[model samples]
Target: MNRNLAYALVVFAATAAAAGQAFAETPTLETTPFVSVKTRADVQAELAQHKANGVNTYSIQYNPLKSFKSTAQREQVVAEYIASRDVVAATTGEDSGSAYFAQARTPHSVSRTLAGTPVNTAR
Candidate 1:
């Protein structure tokens, strides 16, 4: 191969790599509590209180275009809604798209009640 051609190819590869990095858009999914509870008002209200007291926002990291964009956007929008109501603290799926409110924690105990029945290792 010609020396100039080889150099050009190297430059092209580097440029492409840089362009990929520049264009890549990663979606950040941060969970926050949902405001306006009418059905599960009592339970969610308590959860909201706990959230204000400082809780973790389960951040779900993913690529927007190369990964799931819609789901990430949804999560972010929900986060906005939560913020509108001045509620915080949420648990998003680290890699999964699943999202839900995080209730108060009870350490080291496996069992919990979902509605009335005892559920193991979950709140």
Candidate 2:
């Protein structure tokens, strides 16, 4: 009985050591460089093509009241925005246009509870 107990303990310790060594060997990852890289001329040609695709106008909008601390700060923000827009328009052969606003729907079009009655929520 003593010899069998000793044999069992040795087997268990050897199995545990083998498992630890097996887990210690980690596999390494290999990577390759990109097959094709774009050059400066390639990027320029792409931009020219984009310009020819009728994407010639852009618009910028900002809420100055929420973004700025005071009127002077708001004016400075607007000036900077206009300057940046002018720069992009000149460089890309595009024009800066007026700000766009989505049209709001009438109250009757929107769902509302009328006179303590349940409204139909399904479309």
Candidate 3:
């Protein structure tokens, strides 16, 4: 009978400890109601402005560039593309232009005054 009582006491203490830990880990939430910062009229005015600017929020065929007009001629655009072709290729190649940039870099020339050594007095 004493052994059974001690076992029951230990089981009860373990269950109470586990329940207390579970309760401690849970946080009580404070509810705060939302306050509107804009009036209905202001929201309607903004929606009207967006519609006037050709912004269709609910359209399935929305095109942002529908009203775009090109200022450059086709020949000028082609020439610009051709001029930058080599650079674009080098940068986008498998090596990612590291070799091309390394080759293009020029070594810095140090002047006598900045070389931290005395210049020739004979000169």
Best candidate according to TM-score: 3
lDDT of prediction 3: 0.86
Kindly list the per-residue Cα lDDT of model 3 for residues 19-74, writing each as its tens digit. Answer: 86434566777699788999999999998998898868679888878789999999
State the weakest 10-residue window (summed lDDT) of model 3: 109-118
Which ranges in model 1 have alpha carbons more than 4 Å from their true place?
21-123
Ranked by TM-score from best down, the candidates are 3, 2, 1
Better of 1 and 3 by lDDT: 3
| TM-score of candidate 3 against the unseen true structure | 0.47
| Estimated TM-score for each candidate | 0.18, 0.19, 0.47
Q: Residue 18 error for model 2, in Å?
A: 60
Q: 1-123, model 1: which lDDT tens digit per residue?
A: 699999999999998888864476789877886776466888889789978956444536433345444646778998788775532333434623234333343455555556866556686
lDDT of each: 0.63, 0.67, 0.86
Deviation (Å) of 70 in candidate 1: 55
Superposed Cα deviation of residue 61, candidate 3 (Å): 2.3
- lDDT for each residue of candidate 2 in 13-96, tens digit (9 for 90 to 100): 999988874346677866875666888899999999988865544624433344455547778998999988855655455322
Clashes of 2: 0
